[model samples]
Target: MLLQIDLQKEEPIYMQIVHQIIEGIAKNELKPGDDLPSVRSLGADIGINFHTVNKAYQILKQEGFILIHRQKGVVIHPDAAYLANAAYVEKLKRDIRPIIAEAAARNLPIREMEKLVETLYNEMKGE
Candidate 1:
């Protein structure tokens, strides 16, 4: 998975990990039954403590993005569960609302945001 972690940001590392994984799922970069690196391996790959990766994996499991199999490691779910739950949708809206409001406050036009989103989507899809 492609990820960029910001150590200076206020968000926890585990949350950052979770968010990126979720975005990967949303973008279809990760699919159902796709095996993920073990927490220890991911930590080693990312140069972080294994416990940090474990924490993120635990949350992902609880949130149903991944299923933890004994000895087999974690596997991503095919679809995001965020669309199935009102609370999840609300939480997503709440998370994005601040960023949208901030962009508006900074005089960033909605058209620009739309264009940027379209460009990003196209790039992600290699179209």
Candidate 2:
């Protein structure tokens, strides 16, 4: 997985890592059952402490994005389909409501947002 970490961002480093991985999954860059690098290795590669990576991985695991095996390391959860769970849908609304509200506040056009969503969907399908 390729991730860019911004050490200076107001958001925590672990959140950055988590978002990057989430985006990778959304973009199909990381498929179901794909293995993630060890926490130590990923931390070394990103020049961050291992605990940061571990925290991110634990969050992902808790969110059902990945499975953690004691001996096998971490792998994308085989059944980890996003946007399919009621609880997850609620969580997504909680996460996106502010963004949508802000966009509305900025007077961003609905048609433009629809087009962006269509474009992203097409890109994900490699269309």
Candidate 3:
């Protein structure tokens, strides 16, 4: 997987790691059963602390995006339960609410916002 991190960005390194991994999965660059690099290995590759990579992995595991095994290391989750999860939907709403509110405050048309979202979704799917 190819991940680009910008230390200059306001977002933390771990979040950049998490977001890029999620984006990779969305773009079909990462898939179920695919093995991810070990935390230490990835940290070395990215020139970051192992703890940062581990933190990202732990969040991914908690969010049902990946599974960690003692012998096998880390792999993408084999099932799609995370998509159908009620908690996940709630989290999605919470995450999106702020963006929508900001758009509303800025007087952006709802249709335009919907189109923007659709465009991003399509891009993620490689459409």
Best by TM-score: 3
- Name the regions of candidate 2 deviating beyond 4 angstroms: none
Model with the higher lDDT, candidate 1 or 2? 2
Instruction: Name the 10 consecutive residues with the lowest summed lDDT in model 3.
Output: 79-88
8-91 per-residue lDDT for model 1 (tens digits):
899998899998987788677888889999888898888889899899999988888998888877899655444567887788
Best by lDDT: 3
Off by over 4 Å in 1: 2-11, 78-85, 121-127
lDDT of 3 by residue, 11-118 (tens): 999999999999988988898989999999999998999999999999999888899999999999997234556887898999999999999999999999999999
Q: Against the correct fold, how does model 2 do in TM-score?
A: 0.87
Clashes of 3: 0
Predictions: Cα RMSD each = 2.8, 1.7, 1.2
**lDDT of each candidate versus the true structure:** 0.84, 0.88, 0.91
Assess every candidate by TM-score: 0.75, 0.87, 0.94
For candidate 1, what is the TM-score?
0.75
Q: Which residue pairs come into collision in candidate 1? A: none
